[model samples]
Target: MSDTAAERAYRNCVRNLLAQFIHAVQQQPPFILDECDEESLHYLEQLESLPGTTGNEYAELGQAVVCRTIAAFPHLVPLLPRDLLWHFGGDCLHYMPDDEIDKFQQLDERLHQAIGEARPFDYERERAAIFGLH
Candidate 1:
């Protein structure tokens, strides 16, 4: 191929890759990690380790699952990447700005409820909204 054609092809490949990555990342895939199992959860609950709140499993989890799970469990907070935590942080690490605090609290509550009830939610739009990608 000509140099111009080769350059165009390479650029197209990069664009295609970027589109795919964005699509996958925006989908807010489930967080049913291999380690978080029902058997273990039951054992933890029996041991009074898992707080009895929602009494639900984290199956088909939503985008907020990561944050909400960490909140519900608290122990997982340290496991999360600092950047991901910052991505959701508006000002302080745990609080949003004054004007948006209400909305932030509302969202937090929703995540808590979802995590408690193990509700399945497609957070593609939510993720996109966070990054202002779409």
Candidate 2:
């Protein structure tokens, strides 16, 4: 389906954020492997103790890096997809010049409410409803 202009804008902004995040992750290791201590070492041991023990920290590092990177893009908060916006609570991590958390929260609330207005699709029933013949 074709997206509306606003939707396109939102999607593009998110894609930009994702692109920047990926670039950052590629440039830096996901975590401070050099900074690991007794506590962190235990955490790693516990992680490795789990069923799948490939012993690589890449997955965990990748997640932390992605989250931190996303958090950096605060300006993109208001334009994030509804699902992602809900998850972030309207906070974008890195977009420092525009971190109006309250404003983004308000926008998130309104957008989610609008999303809630869309009922589950029922082709035949919806067609009848639109034609006033249900």
Candidate 3:
């Protein structure tokens, strides 16, 4: 099946977030890499080498790194972008409660609607509103 508009938007968000993350790690490699397991490092290496690739190309590897980071270094969880968990879905969902998932789904729907209408959509602001953050 073809991807829906929402799916495309979600993929774009994930790709942008993942790229930002990779850039951050590249900037301060040792700080993050010293704690990563061999598998995570390998995935990061693969992802880092393919700069500017589409989300589909590196998303699974990005997901692997995110999942491994959560499992191997729980303390780093806060450092990792929270939106990535919702955008990546699959194994990443294991870390989020059902309520949080619902909120993310709602946020995505709102984002899609905004896009469909050509209205401005501030993702972080919308997300904070949905999550009841100040």
Candidate 4:
């Protein structure tokens, strides 16, 4: 296959795989990635880049990341690169309901560390950890 075609095919596969994983866990999705506005994307990007370990920064980034990741769960429909997908999903725990948030964290232990830490995140490392679950 040509590079473009191969890439397209791969994305489709990733989308299906991740979407299935999300479905299995039964968490509420935060948003449709494709339908998200630039404003939303910008917010997510900022959350991803936010420095960890400050007052409330860890929780803030974790909620932002998890909610966006789940809300934008369908981003997998486009098979976005793992790093990009995970990057947009960064943030703390306030946006989602409390009951669901704990389950979400329980679904992925690394998610807990990523959000709990008080330092800058490592997306590549996050990807390596979660891709195993997918």
RMSD of each: 17.1, 14.0, 4.3, 13.8
TM-score of 2: 0.32
Measured by lDDT, the strongest candidate is 3
Q: What is the TM-score of each candidate against the true structure?
A: 0.25, 0.32, 0.69, 0.27
Clashes found in each candidate (C-alpha, N, C closer than 3 A): 0, 9, 0, 21
lDDT of each: 0.39, 0.39, 0.71, 0.44
Instruction: Judge candidate 4 at residue 93 and give its lDDT.
Output: 33
Model 1 steric clash pairs:
none
Q: Model 4, range 26-86, lDDT digits (tens) per residue?
A: 3322334456567656654554354333446744654455565546554533332333233
Residue 60 in candidate 1, Cα distance off native in Å: 29
lDDT of 3 at 115: 68
Please identify which of the two predictions, 2 or 4, would achieve the higher TM-score against the true structure: 2
Model 3 steric clash pairs: none
User: In candidate 2, where is summed lDDT lowest over 10 consecutive residues?
Assistant: 83-92
